[model samples]
Target: MAAADSEQIRRRYDRLAPWFDSLEGILEGLLFRRLRKKLWSQASGGHILEVGVGTGKNFAFYPDGARITGIDFSPKMLEQAQRKRQRKQIAVDLAQMDVQALDYADNSFDTVIASFVFCSVPKPRRGLKELYRVCKPGGQVLLLEHVLSSNRFMDFMMNLLNPLVVKTLGANINRETLKNVQACPFRNVYTDPASSDMIKLIRAIK
Candidate 1:
């Protein structure tokens, strides 16, 4: 991702921080439950690292025995994630950090997860490289991303409405997110095709 684009996304998320929890409260169960199921099934336990963990919406679904660290660019979003944890007693090491620059040491985590996140990251490829760099070589990078639909007509509509959409949701409507993943440093990947059209569930090793 370019520096300008990174700043754009960071600024957008910062703006959305106030309503971040409420917006997630609406889409929480339906959108994230599916994400949880697929990710856990592929990679279980072992010091998990989650990037772009907005409002900690996926916290409830992670395994009780796993060690987890979650980071997001928006501090308000992290506060919301902290609020959710006070009651559930889930132990998550949360921080406000940009995806393009991870703070951990090399081979820091056994599993790295991203869900509906990379689309808004300035350099999705750069972020993916950070993901790979931090993962223990055998560990997997699980992604549950929403991509631009393959349908040309839908693509056209998405292109036309992207500006309004990004302003409203802080999301990218026109990112060919799958292609971005395909270009990353991963192998032995698995993607659910039917699910891959709009939302792709992938498991790839570093």
Candidate 2:
């Protein structure tokens, strides 16, 4: 069952590989960059491990000389990121890995970043626990996620339509992902506005 869940999601993403860049690449990049500029104070000169680094949209904003290692389940996505390696100043090593079961040693990174990733991770809590485990003590984890709305009307519509939305976007629209991240035995969770009940900036520590 677990394998099926993983495969199904991967297949969905694989199908969307070509269109993915055009659809979410620039628009999401703009949104993420605006928020990241505000959050750079937390991440300046940090070693970064980015999960779900689809197309490497965040690569442009990472400070010069930041050590960045990116991982994603989709091979296609990582390939898209590799295409832009030259223009970047940072040291980047990207790989394909499962978020819930990372292959790195514990406390390996100075900063960890995820954007709109956790909601569809097969196992959200375990993925977060792994993220925390990989991050060094006092190092930070950053996320930008579109989570469930608190308003009953939007929540109801989301609950009804999210399954279909997930097939298209490769993520859930109504997940309480911030709550899940906070519950994952981490510390100092903070969130900023992305939309109504959709947070754009989330930072914390392992």
Candidate 3:
């Protein structure tokens, strides 16, 4: 991603921070909440790194004994997450960091996770590689994402509307996330349908 594009996304998310949760409240109640619980249940715990931990929505589902570090590129988003962390008494270290260029050492974490995040990353493959790099050799990488549909008509519609969605929401609704994951070095990569064919729960072994 270019510096300008990245900055634009950061600014957009910062502006959306305050109303982020409310904006997706209906979707959260109807679908995302259940998917999040399923995603967290697969966590190996120990040292965990959660990328794009927007507003800390996944904080409540974190398993006991997990030492979690959450990062996001937007400071305002992190601020919202911090407030949630405090209100819920969740033990997590929040930081402002970009997933495309993580600041951690190689093999720094036992598990790496993300939820509905890859579509917004300007360079999704680079971010996945960073996730692969920071995770231990035998560690787990779990993700919850919405991807381009297999249906040709729906795929065409998503591609057609993707630009408008990106312009307004800073997220692409038509990402080929499963293919991107396959391009990474992670082993045992697989995915399961989450809410629908468009949403997926991805699992990979690093």
Candidate 4:
């Protein structure tokens, strides 16, 4: 669940939500859409849970006929996602929920997915544990995230900018999320660099 800083994050995202779709659209169109498409297309038909589903950006990328439940802690962000869902006629159950403590029972979902979310989580490992707990045995967990770069210059730049970035955007630019995922209780962990080793597409099994 959210910690003491969660209210700050919520306020930040709530403030950002009004214009976030347009800004994210421009950004994703320029940089992230292709990788997101590739990653989301791999999703098979099943009961899917998407955590931190900001503006429902992945709604169009999911395979047709797949059941989806999308959750986010930010209600304002979820409102945008709901609008997009209506516009696209995408069938999804949207909820305002925290990731660290999922409301669902154990082994409830066939697949769990998140995109660019862990960097903003106040308690990432706890959130990851929840994902593991809700996912049925043999189900998959997929994530698309930006992490600290392997390149010295890029890593240094990200580190230098991280505090301000987190303050302003509620997202850390230098998170070692893939490493965190590897350390979690998941099996068959696989990672592919999605952008010059800065962004990664990760797949693991519960």
Candidate 5:
């Protein structure tokens, strides 16, 4: 993906930062919170890295004693996350960083996590490769992502609407994230349906 595209996404997210939580509040209350908990529960809680930690929606779910570092490309989004962190007194290191170009050293984290993030990343495969790079040899990669549906009609609709969705929300509605994860160096990849077949709980070993 081009640098311009990545910067565009960052700008879009920064613009959305103030309204993001309220915009997704209903869905979060009804479903996302449960999925977040399930995803966090799988964490080994040792030197974790969370990619695209937007507005710190997962802050409440961080495991006890987990050494966490959360990164995002949008500074405004990180600001929202920081406020939440302070209010909750969560122990997390927050940074402005891109998943596709992580600054961490090789084999740096015990667990790497990304939730609802790949769809917005300009280069999903590149981001996944970075996750594989930063994670320890035996560490885990946990993801909660929504993907293109297997149903032909739904897939077609998603493809049709994806451009508009991305333009307005800075997130693509039709990403093939599970396949992207498989294409990376990670091993023992596994997926389970978190909400129908479209939304998946993907787990892989690094």
Candidate 6:
């Protein structure tokens, strides 16, 4: 995708920042939080980076004392995340950065994470490559995402809805993320369905 399109997506998210926390709260309660907690709780130690860390929703789920850096493309979202971090007294480094072009050095983090993020990335593979680049050798990447379904009926529905969804929210509802992960350089990829094969939790070693 072009840089201009990516910027537009960022702006959309920034505009949504004010209501995102509340909106996501209801969505999380429906199912997202359970999977988020399950995946995030596995980062036992070492420096961790969360891509698309909107409002730091998974912040509290990370193990205590873990060194964490959270980045998002949306400044307004990052501001809300900062407020949450301060209010909850969570120690973390927060920055406004794009996942597709991370600023961090190679092999800088022991673990990389992203949740419900790839669907909105203008270039998902590029973003995944960046995730792979920043992760240390032998480190792991954890992701919780909703992807294109294997079920033809559901897949058709998601595909049918994707354009409208993307136009409105800048999030595609039919991303084939597990396939993308398999295509990336990361090894030992594993995925399990979290919600009827629509949402998934993915793990990979770098």
The weakest ten consecutive residues by lDDT in model 1 span 23-32
RMSD of candidates 1 onward, in order: 2.0, 2.2, 1.0, 1.5, 1.0, 1.2
Candidate 6 lDDT, 69-155, residue by residue in tens: 999999999999999999999989999898989998999999998999999999999999999999999999998988888999998
Instruction: Write down the lDDT that model 4 would get.
Output: 0.87
Q: Which residue pairs come into collision in candidate 5?
A: none
Task: Look at candidate 5 and tell me the lDDT of residue 162.
Answer: 95
lDDT of 2 by residue, 36-117 (tens): 5665545743578888877776776666677778898988777777776655544689899989889999998988888778
Q: Using lDDT as the measure, what is the rank order of every candidate, best first?
A: 3, 5, 6, 4, 1, 2
Once superposed on the true structure, which residue ranges of model 1 sit more than 4 Å away at CA?
A: 1-4, 24-27, 193-196
Clashing pairs in 3: none
Tens digit per residue, CA lDDT, model 5, 56-152: 9999889898799999999999999999999989999999999989999999999999999999999899889999999999999999999999999
User: For model 3, what is the error of residue 65's alpha carbon versus the real structure, in angstroms, after optimal superposition?
Assistant: 0.7
Residue pairs of candidate 4 with colliding backbone atoms: none
Residue 26 error, candidate 3, Å: 0.3
Give the clashing residue pairs of candidate 2, or none: none
- Estimate the lDDT of model 1: 0.80
Which candidate would rank higher by lDDT, 1 or 6? 6
Local distance difference test scores for all models: 0.80, 0.78, 0.93, 0.87, 0.92, 0.88
CA lDDT, candidate 4, residue 66? 77
Could you give candidate 3's per-residue lDDT for residues 143-172 as a string of tens digits? 999999999999999999999999999999
Which ten residues in a row are the worst by lDDT in model 6? 190-199
Model 5 lDDT at residue 165: 94
Model 1, residue 196: C-alpha shift (Å): 4.5
